[model samples]
Target: MQTVEHESFGSPTEIREFPHGHAEILNVGDATIGRLVLEPGWRWSNDVKPIAGTESCLAPHFQYHVQGRLGIRMDDGEEFIAGPGDVTSLPEGHDAWVVGDEQVIVVDWFGATDWAKEPAGNVAAHA
Candidate 1:
């Protein structure tokens, strides 16, 4: 048997909004993908930490930078900047922010399913 599925961010299955960014999620086959649009000044530690209720981003992401720049700092103090056409494999326990004044757009192949959602059984824990 063969199957093909098509999905688009234009009509995402879910949209997760945070302080300075949003993630549009799509479910195609067994994969959950996300298109994240981060405005300038959007920082994972400052924006998504509250909703995630974790000290750092715990979602391990394999993403393609579509536009703008994104600065990432791992918990181990490693840092780098990703720009358009860059592909990044980010493990859990890292903080990221948009670099410069350009809005950042990324397509995440991994870690989108629960990227900005609260942990299980901890609704509004940081509110």
Candidate 2:
């Protein structure tokens, strides 16, 4: 067993950033944890879809909302808002965005590997 501590979202193995959002990825043991910060006016379609090359976000997520508010809209037209202290398990084929003026923070234990990743063969496209 081992222990790793940080004052905040520090010492990340990888960090993916877009125009209005960013994900700090930390590798611990066999898990990849992602700390996502979505600024106000950030929307998955407008911010991340081009990188992913998908109509909706294809990365499924199991995360904990840390602060602010986030809105989610599924492909089937289902929609909801997730706020602070909420635990969410979002499947693939969804769009998400920040709902308020505050930045939305989330810690995801799943789907961090490909979140915000530029599609294969399109490395310089989103850069």
Question: How high is the CA lDDT of each candidate model?
Answer: 0.89, 0.86
Off by over 4 Å in 1: 122-127
TM-score of 1: 0.93
Can you write out model 1's per-residue Cα lDDT over 1-127, one digit (the tens) per residue?
7598888889999998888889999999989999999999999889998788878887889999999999999999999999999999988889999999999999999989888876678443321
Candidate 2 stretches greater than 4 Å from native: 1-8, 122-127
Candidate 2 versus the native: TM-score? 0.88
Q: Report the poorest 10 consecutive residues by lDDT, candidate 1.
A: 118-127
Superposed Cα RMSD, model 1: 2.6
Best by lDDT: 1
108, model 2: CA deviation in Å? Answer: 0.7
Give the lDDT of residue 27 in candidate 2.
78
lDDT of candidate 2 over 1-127, digit per residue (tens): 7776553467688889998989998877777889999999999999988787778887889999999999999999999999999999988889999997999999998988778877677442221
By TM-score, who's the top model here? 1
Error of 2 at 65 (Å): 0.2
Worst 10 residues of 2 by lDDT: 118-127
